[model samples]
Target: MLGKILRIIGIILMGLASALMILGGIGTVCIAWFPENWESLAMMAPYKLIFQTAVIFTILAGILGFWATIKLARRKPNGWNMAVIALLLSLATAGTKMYFSNMARGSVAPTNMRFYFSLFVLLYFLALRIPAIWDKIRFEGDQPDEGVGGLAGGAAAIVAGGLTLTVHLWAGPSHTVNGINYVAYLQTELLAAGVGLIIVGLIPLALDLWKTAVSRHTSETLKIPVIDNRA
Candidate 1:
């Protein structure tokens, strides 16, 4: 009964996460892409490229999250793995946002609340891995869990970050296109470099996090029928 309750709560949290990602991504893209007036224009002019790139990642995460949620609802085999992915992406973004925002403000007292909230939810998600919960959620099928086999995301991040930094160097600090706020580091081409590095760093960290979370209670230790959740 407790497992069932936790499962229900997890689904609700998952759905909320998906909706927030989609809505927030779209809103940010609209504002940054179409700056309505001078204030909005000035706000996004410097870091528009970063905003655009993150927006792409955000939308993808949201879509995958929704797909995974549907799969879970239907007890599909791939749902477990997909949910892990969606949660990882969401964690990456939340951490990056919190880091950059704190850096910009030069204070950590009042951080982006999403960071803490996402982390708590992530831990809660991990706690739901009890065998009883898994017995309820896991369907009989192939568990295509290749958590360590793939470096594609990390390699892609490296290339993107390297290219961004290269562009930043080539741009030569001349007005950040010499059009808008060309001088500020946080608001100029430098921001792209920062965001790019964050992406590069976070991918592996998220992967490691996933590995650690799923490895906590193996069949050997739990003494039950193992439903491999490492994906």
Candidate 2:
């Protein structure tokens, strides 16, 4: 019962995060492109990159968290992994944004929305780590082979990282004043995450391959007939 409740809460938090991200993204875009008086909003331009980065980070992590929790409810092993990653990403991105917001604005009050969201994040991570909760969602039945999937995922991540890096390069150097290229730095961080994803995806494949090789070698060794010819 507790697990179920936790799952429901997690799903709700992720959905709320997604909605917040969408709204934030829309606002950011409008602020970036639609301001009629550029001079009036010139002060806002410097922080545009931060908003954009937040938009991407929030949207991606929120959506991923939503899907991952759903998968967890359905008892898929990969779901836990994805959920963990999503939460971590959310921590890094949303958490950072929240921290800055707290600094720029005022410290979040215990009754504030940020406080609730932070609580939700903490609770969700804790729920996910509970072995009892995991056992409740444990997938039964024949497991699908992950070798192909891992390889595919790895390849996709590598290709995506390469493409993202290329686009960042082609887009030209990020706007810089006073030695800060916030957008560029965020993009580079994203590129690094992509590379990390590639590595993550590859690990399962490597393990699978190693296991297959070892099994084959053992089977071959076992197949060797004991030469009773010495008799």
Candidate 3:
């Protein structure tokens, strides 16, 4: 019962996080296209600060969702693995972004550092998705406990990471101006990362639905014994 309750709560938190991600994505995309709009809003410094506060809140909510899932998964083997990987990926991505942001602000050109950090974030995102894919395939009762789904998911992640790395390698370095443009770039990346996270966050809920359906079916099929067998 506790597990069920926690799982439900985790799902709710994950959904909330996903919604925030979508909002953040939309906001970032809008800002990217209309940089001038932000300039005008910049005049209202307090409003701009409020917007920043919202962004931070959104990030914190996402982190909380991930942490909640991790906590709920403590006893469940597969779920635990998924939660741990997701949490680690989230942290690594955040760390890499911070590192790159600092590098972009410093006097020296940290092109290599930036590239590698981006690659690291990409890899972490890919790794995080593995558990989602595994959850999908392992939902069925007939499936063996051989961990095949996880291995397949890991392979898929490897391919994804490789592709992202290729794109990073081909992409040119972003220009920075007083760290303003760097901030914009970081926001853009965060938006993209949020989208990825939103997708991952949805997976567990979908898996839970699938599991509930299976359980209901199984329960309905089971026959209850009475003193006498009656129609």
Candidate 1 ranges with C-alpha deviation above 4 Å:
40-43, 101-113, 136-231
TM-score of 3: 0.28
**lDDT tens per residue, model 2, 1-231:** 554455545544543443333323332343344333344335455456675676576567657865664454344567656766765665565555555545543432211333345356656656666786755423222444334334434443444345334533432232332555334645755567557645754675688789899999999988967668776
RMSD in Å for all candidates: 16.9, 12.4, 15.0
Steric clash pairs (candidate 2)? none
- In the range 73-144, model 3's lDDT, one tens digit per residue, is 332345434434443433443344334434433321222333343344335334434664435433224534
lDDT of each structure?
Answer: 0.53, 0.50, 0.39
How big is the positional error of residue 82 in model 3, measured in Å on the Cα after superposition?
18
Write down the TM-score of every candidate.
0.51, 0.44, 0.28
Task: Show the lowest summed lDDT stretch of 10 residues, model 2.
Answer: 106-115
Clashing pairs in 1: 175-178
Better of 2 and 3 by TM-score: 2
Candidate with top lDDT is 1
Highest TM-score among the candidates is held by which one?
1
Range of the 10 consecutive residues with the lowest summed lDDT in candidate 3? 163-172
Clashes of each: 1, 0, 0
